[model samples]
Target: MSVMVAVPDSAEGALALTSAIAEARLLGTDVLAVNLGLRPISPEHLMSGETRITILERTHHESHAEVVLHALAEHPETERLVIGVKRRSKVGKALIGSVSQTLLLEADVPILAVKLPH
Candidate 1:
């Protein structure tokens, strides 16, 4: 089995993703950490090899979900997906939208979400 993790350009998101990757390893699932940074292929900040990391450029300003879906469309070989979501209180949740929420709702494969520690 395999999993895709959406990693944004933030340290907290990265840490959460690393935790999710560790969990995937324990679960025997291959990890694919997708870094949709400001530009494509900016794999410089992250370590190499321990996890399968792929950095992609944003295809559209409003089409991030579609970009992710298209990227993983060929993952018939994978089993699941993972993403990181920053924890938020009721008021916070009311303000900021969540990518993890959208992915969980739309992805054809099962989605797993890791949140920033409270």
Candidate 2:
């Protein structure tokens, strides 16, 4: 089994990636990271040369949440999914749909939702 993480273009995404790496180490598995951001993620910079990381580029047609869900479906060996979340008010969430929330509700596998350090 492997740990899957959604890497967006935010600090929370970076934190989630780091957390996924640690969890993968504990689980003795590799990491599958779906790149949902425009910026490229360098495996050498984030990884410690221990766990192998596979980066999957997202297609423009799908939303970030959709891409992650599709990845989960494509890779059944994924043991867990890690995603970055931000604190949002009820009103804000109502106004703008949340990808993390959608994943939490829809994903079949266990989820690790992380936020930026205070």
Candidate 3:
């Protein structure tokens, strides 16, 4: 079993990556960290030894949500998906579509939405 993690460029993304690593360690599964932007992941963020982390960088012009959904489809071994979700109000959500919300609705496997600590 594998866990696919979407690592965006935000505090919530950091939390999601860290949490995904921990979950992978506990489950003895590998982590596929998909970076969907131009910014590369810092060295500190790549500190997982128990489970191997395969980083897939996609700097294309596609939307982050689309990239994540594509990765989910590409990786059939992924049993669960981990992503960061910010608390958005109803109006905020309606105004701006959230990637996490989209994945939650569209993903075929189980999804874990991690949020930043208060």
Candidate 4:
């Protein structure tokens, strides 16, 4: 089993990545990181001797939520999905759908939602 995380180019994403790595270490499993950012994640910065991390690139055609869900479906060994979330107004969420919300509702696997410290 492995831990999966959706990593975007934001502070929340960074926290989620760090949290996923820590959780994987505890679970004694590897990490499957789905990169949702426009730019690729730096493997050298994320890699550690204790845990193995594999970064999956996002296709141009796929939505952020789709990419994450697809990765989970592809990797049946994924024990958990880690995602970073921030507060959003109801109006904002209504106007712009939330990826985290979609994952929370649709993902078949367990989800670990992390947030930045105020």
Best by lDDT: 4
Number of clashing pairs per prediction, in order: 0, 0, 0, 0
Rank order (by TM-score, best first): 3, 2, 4, 1
lDDT of 3: 0.87
Worst 10 residues of 2 by lDDT: 41-50
In terms of lDDT, the poorest run of 10 residues in model 4 is 41-50
The C-alpha TM-scores of every prediction are 0.69, 0.92, 0.93, 0.91
Error of 4 at 56 (Å): 0.7
lDDT per residue (tens digit) for residues 4-116 in model 3: 99998898888889999998988889999999756898789988876799998985677788898888888999988999999878899889887887889998999888887
Which residue runs does candidate 3 get wrong by more than 4 Å?
A: none
Q: Which regions of candidate 1 are displaced past 4 Å?
A: 27-29, 39-62
TM-score of 3: 0.93
Identify the superior model by TM-score, candidate 1 or candidate 2. 2
Predictions in order: lDDT: 0.65, 0.90, 0.87, 0.91
Candidate 2: C-alpha lDDT? 0.90
The superposed Cα distance between candidate 4 and the true structure at residue 17, in angstroms, equals 0.4
Residue 58 of model 1, lDDT score: 56
Give me the overall lDDT of model 4. Answer: 0.91
